[model samples]
Target chain A: DAGITQSPRYKITETGRQVTLMCHQTWSHSYMFWYRQDLGHGLRLIYYSAAADITDKGEVPDGYVVSRSKTENFPLTLESATRSQTSVYFCASSPGTGAGPQHFGDGTRLSIL
Target chain B: QQQVKQSPQSLIVQKGGISIINCAYENTAFDYFPWYQQFPGKGPALLIAIRPDVSEKKEGRFTISFNKSAKQFSLHIMDSQPGDSATYFCAARTNDMRFGAGTRLTVKP
Candidate 1:
């Protein structure tokens, strides 16, 4: 079904450069989220959108920007990326919050050099 | 509280054995507790989940035990298998959400 897909499955960027990770879902879920996974921190939410054009900050939103121009697409942009931003980024979506389970993407392994 | 605490940073179990992972939270408003399994190079996928109103829920070889009063929950894998080996994360969802540091599980055949 290609339920959820994330692009640039692997990315390597230099510090201070802008990098964007793409996420798309075919289910047309109402809630989409961006999370970064680190060794000791587990998964930390970066940004979330309730629906198109309705976005909110998450636990770890610094240095990252997100927009849901369409219900199926939510992209995360790391402005002036830093080494600290290097982590496995996961995109997830749920039919609704606290009610339905979130489906996750394979994730994008981003390396900020 | 927004924190969800998990124990045993890692676990090893033999096939046909039982594997359990525990998580505790401080928020009483959290009604949804879910466990996710993540393989290397992949995203975390829902393994099992439970609601506070229910004390336990089971699916196939996986089960979730919830203790609302204690603000704790756990995932139990019966008849552990090698394919079940993965990093497990416990998450509590309220109006806001938080996740526990994952536990890496290794099942030996």
Candidate 2:
């Protein structure tokens, strides 16, 4: 497809297990972002990458790791999943940092048991 | 402090009625404001957007009204319909973009 896509649409993992959510975009955008959505919290940014090998922390980056080895891929990994981390994770991409509308992936629903 | 604040956690309106959602921001540096609509099990899609330079922008049935001095903006849906039911998020961007808590709107028959 021509748009962004996320893998493992639905996942269930143990609390201490490691889990990674993959996000890929065909647009070759310069910016990619990872956000977690929970009830009452809307969407909180976890991490974002400005370009290849350039990433920065967002509002809630703890326990989450993101890497952008390629401009088309930015993957988020949880070193040790926790019950609190059970939420719908979304991946988005933008052409650049300023005044651009972000294109979002369908989202990954992760449940930590 | 919460940079962006949205009101009316939830809203319900009958078909043909108007639906309004409001948001306020504390950051004066925010120059761009956008609203996104999300259906169940789907990611949010940009609905309409506006800049502080203009007081109002309308596209189809959606309109964004901005008040720079007040640090507030609102979304007004003209002639709401059942198909319009969804969660709407108001967001602001300057150097960074931040989304509000979101408002769930349900349009009934």
- The lDDT for every candidate, in the order shown, is 0.90, 0.92
Best by DockQ: 2
DockQ value of candidate 1: 0.65
Q: In model 2, which regions exceed 4 Å deviation? A: none
TM-score of each: 0.96, 0.96
lDDT of 1 by residue, B48-94 (tens): 78888899999999999988888888999999999999999999887
Please report the candidate that would top lDDT against the real structure.
Answer: 2
Candidate 2 lDDT, A1-113, residue by residue in tens: 69989998999999999999999999999999999988877888899999999999988999999999999999999999999999999999999877544799999999999
List runs of model 1 lying over 4 Å from the truth: none
Per-residue lDDT tens digits of candidate 1, residues A5-102?
99999999999999999999999899999998888787888889999999999888999999999999999999899999999999999988875347
Task: Report the CA-based lDDT of candidate 1 relative to the real structure.
Answer: 0.90
Chain B TM-score (each prediction, in order): 0.96, 0.98
